[model samples]
Target: MKKTLPAYLGISFVWFSAHFGGGFASGRQIVAFFLNHQWTSLFMPAFSMLIMGLTFYFSMVIAAKFNTYDYSTWSKKVYGNLAPVMAPVFEIMFNALLVLVTAVAFATGGSTLAKAFGTPYMLNTVVLAAVIFVLTIYGADLVRKSATVVSLILIACIFIIYVPNIIYFFPKIIHNFAAVKSGEIVTGTQNSFLDTIWWAAKYGALQCCAIGAYIVHAQACPDKASLKKAAIVGFFINTVVMYLSYFGILAFVDQGVLKEAVPSLFVVMNGVGGAWMTVLISLCIVIGAVSTGVALVYGTTNRLANFFGRNMSEEERAAKRKIHCISSSAMLVIACWMVAQLGLIPLIGKGYGNIGWVSLLLLTVPILLRGLGLWRFAEDVPGKVAAE
Candidate 1:
């Protein structure tokens, strides 16, 4: 028998794609969470990713140990006897997060293309929704593969768009860095370092919710070591890309980049590249949004399918799983498109913050408390590896 090896790279890319989605790509999340806090922006993103990576590591290890790949089952194990009480609450929180992030992603793609090509926002949103719907129809394997492809393209585009701007605006970034340090350039409502730390924590909690997407793929990891490697790799990917984008956006702080609806597009329009860069970044944003939607939508669809098919036998459920997948995918996608109408900025700024706080209580805190105590026993079984 051929051994099924863990897909560390693929897992890392899935986490990365989910994190570097619409909000991060548009620079809205950075501005809202990190950059808005002024000088704290320099290191806060790294701090946030650290929190996220740790959470992901523990979550994956727990999933691998318990042979529970879905978030619902995984959460129940993590919660132990509290499963009966807390599991349903977690279910609600996870679904709410799915709705919010997926909606933001759709809004991001729609708004990005609308701004880039002067198209109708609704049409753009619907088109983006359709793309995600098709992508989510397949299953976890396809979601993983698509994430790898999208993440590579996004990484290249981010470097392409951000590197030039960072080069061209080096002096401005340096000046702003010093100004922020000296309390001369503060864009945030609160300039305290502790406040920035708090904000980073909140953002970390929100990002931690991506474990819903990742848990389904945890069975792909053959060992706890692979899970750790995936988290560390994911950490570096998120941190480096975040730092680059943060620096690039910082260059425009004095120019009021935060005031713009899409700070990244504003940066590109005002930075090293010209019209071509605009088109490229626009493409980058749309694809990033789609990648996020695909992973998240599939995660939710998986759970929904399991829920709706809970009473059926194995053979019957297998026959109806695809239909369940399609139905759930369509319901979630349509709901998200409607939510996207609330606009991108509001979704990132207002919606994300609230979700972060709630997630910290319902998701992040439970994982940390439970994972620390349970991880020592989470060794992989030799012949019991989950089938993909």
Candidate 2:
């Protein structure tokens, strides 16, 4: 069979699927980070996506260039001699992020479904966890494929729901902007430009760490050229969808929609009301959450499986992958459910910003420097000589 997708698009979809999770699809994270900043919400989302796109491009390039598919080996390539110490520290931090994001997915999925179906939140969460667990066990290839399919449906649903609202609410959007500019309304926590940008950058920083998940698929990226294509394709897909969702959510900010757990759903309920559209929006959120949960769970699973199977022969390791995957997925899903009790707002607000700061200090800065050639991995010496 000819492949269902070229390697580049597959990689791109993986990036999109992993990034557009509960926090994003719900529009709560955008409200928490961007819309609260009022007028800065206009461009800060695009800026934040740019930061993520560039960082993803750089990270994928390094991974492709070095041929380090898993985070364990990739960190070794990135950190050089410092790998002995820094790698384990980075692993702990990265796993914390995995847990945090996956937990948000569980929380977001459960809350949305429970509200829509009038079911128990815990029941909804258990079902959501089961779905993610099934997807995750199939491993990276299935995750990428599912991401592409789920993301396509999500994009269509978003356009159907959001475009109508943006058009209908044009007058309110303009009036709100004017109100913010005139100092008649201040939506942000701090009214300063620097503060808004800092928050936006934190959003970017949290996203940049998804490269840990992205690089596991790097082997599919035949070369740096393919990786670049994947990065650009993924970047545009993510940024465009985010902008659409942001504007739709922005139109309702003045209506106190930001106070809602799922602001995008509020936009659908009030702005684009049909019983079907409400269910559609709810479905969008849950699937998006599942897509993210699957990817993050699988990424962490790959790392753990690799560590435990280090002493095993290739045959032995391959045989054991399913076992490792099951254990890892179960452990992660349970942790995520427990953390989900903290609720959506608290996770996006208090939990994510800290991850972003830690990611910037530990992951993004070093990756940026190394990708720019400001620092060299000892592994690069032979490749550098070959080019000469």
Candidate 3:
């Protein structure tokens, strides 16, 4: 079961697609965290890469060595007596957040399609939900494989649309930076350097909940070396795509033309290919949303089944899981549709902003402490003698 590089990349693509959902795909997060800060935001990509790389590596290692794949077991192993208290808290918050974000994806994708094709927004939402439901039913392996292809296509399409914009707009971007430094542009609330660093750290920490299951999936790796390498590769791929999109957004900051709900689409629509490019960009956004929504639903369903199906026979468990998946998917779609009516910005700001801090305290801290050897649990490591 020694995993090859392609095997690692395939999983990494899943990790990337899962995370690159509503906020990242839509360019709203980049605007809030990075683009708003202008040139000072350049450092975020590197800082994010560091935190996520370490987190992914350790998460995979712990899952492999401990034989715990789900977050409930992993948290218990890391938190000890606090597992009862911490596990439910993490599960409830994480699952709810996943539902909220998936809703955002549906809203985002639906709106984009509506603008592009003049289709009814609710119709688009229904279509998006159906696509995610089908994908979730096929389960993780299919999602991972399909995501690999989608991620590659996204990267290619993004670069084709944005790289030239970066070159053509480089001068304007530099000028805008100068204006901001001179206090002439009035770019609104500005974060101090330290504040920017903290935001990057917190954002990276929040991603652990989203990708934790994928790390669990990484347990298929035959050895520690393969797992570590896969994590690193995955981290780099995510980082690179993030920065490329950031730069794309940055290029348009000076012109003040990025006022649309989907700023990335605005960028493409105004760039080389014009209207045709917007259609292609719209497709990318929808696919990104679908990938993200499917991952969230799959993760939520998997967690619930693992939590409640512990005593069921294998056949019984499978039957119950199917029921759970279908019901959860329907619930998520309805909830998300209701929430989407409130708009994307509010959903992301309120939902993610609050959870980010909790994750830092509960999820990230315990895992980091265990991974760094600063804390150890007697029963955490599987296959080890109690005395050892």
Candidate 4:
């Protein structure tokens, strides 16, 4: 069956695409993280690419080798009760992160449609949220297909708009390169490595590791070799896409102005790419946003059903299920939308990274403890894994 073509890679790409969106969707994140340094943003993604690549290998490798999809089982065996104890915290973090992502999708989608046409933000928001809910209730195949299409669209738009621009800015790129190499220019974002690590932790990278592992377990890969291959492939694909996205933003926007917007990639892109292309990518961004909402909510709902021992509803029982589902969906959307509307950019800015930390602390600690010869102290607890 071609083993489903590694759904995790496609998921990772869509997931990482969320991280690379927002302010970093333009050049701001790159400017903050690597442009301040030498040729590092160029190299930073690669460095992460390498570390994540190795870590991913181990994740799928271990899970697949065990033939056990219950990540909790692995976690407990690796970290004793500590892994089990941390489950609630990880879920809370994930829920909060999902709430926030949903908000971003709604707000961004509304803003884009409002900007492009005379659409009411609320109406646009309602339309988008409804779409997100439908997509979520349906599941991942729709999301993967949607994301694959949207990612391709944005990727094409980025190339068409930014490649020549980068070539044009080659001189500035060189000057920035020499300055960073010579340590002559510091855009003065200190603790940048720690910042990115902290950033990676707070946001999706670390969380995505867990998510990736979950997907691996869900898909029921039967061997360490298969699992590791999946993780490596997933991370490698994600990092490349993220880095390409970073440069695309840089090539198209002025870094100085990008610093001010802080969270809106569109302000930067719309300015540089011409209003029409800006409008086009904005719609694409909104589409990607919907894809994200679909992916997260779909994953979350399935996870929740598994958590609560709920079966997939069939027939008229689905009516009650529908109520339950809509309640959950509404709660998430409204809360996130409120946050988005209230200008919680500063607060939610680290949402992804914070959740990432929780995921890393729970998952990585267990693996490291086990891998580093500390396994005897742990226990194997019951865990459930489902990819249905």
The TM-score values for the models, in the order shown, are 0.92, 0.93, 0.89, 0.74
Q: Candidate 1, TM-score vs. the true structure?
A: 0.92
Q: What lDDT does model 2 reach?
A: 0.80
RMSD list, candidates in order:
3.2, 2.5, 3.3, 5.1
Worst 10 residues of 3 by lDDT: 379-388
Show pairs that collide, candidate 1: none
Pairs in clash, predicted candidate 3:
none
Which ranges in model 1 have alpha carbons more than 4 Å from their true place? 1-6, 342-348, 374-388
Better of 2 and 3 by TM-score: 2
TM-score of model number 2: 0.93
Task: Write the residue-wise lDDT of candidate 4 on 276-376 in tens digits.
Answer: 66665565567756766666666565554333335555554445654655555665656666766765655655454555566666655556455445554
Clashes per candidate (backbone, < 3 Å): 0, 1, 0, 6
lDDT of 3 by residue, 252-348 (tens): 7766744556788778877667887878888888888888887777766566657567898988888788776667666766676677767664757
Q: Which tens-of-lDDT digit does each residue in 1-388 have in candidate 1?
A: 0133247878898998888887788888889898888576678888888889888988887787677777888888877777899888888888778888888888778877887789999999899999999989988887878888889899999999999899988998999989878888778775677888988999999988767888888877658777788899899998999988899999999889988778998998899898898899889888888988888888888888998899999999999999999999999999988888876556355878888888888788878876666432333234433332
Q: Please identify which of the two predictions, 2 or 4, would achieve the higher lDDT against the true structure.
A: 2
The Cα local distance difference test for each model comes to 0.83, 0.80, 0.73, 0.53
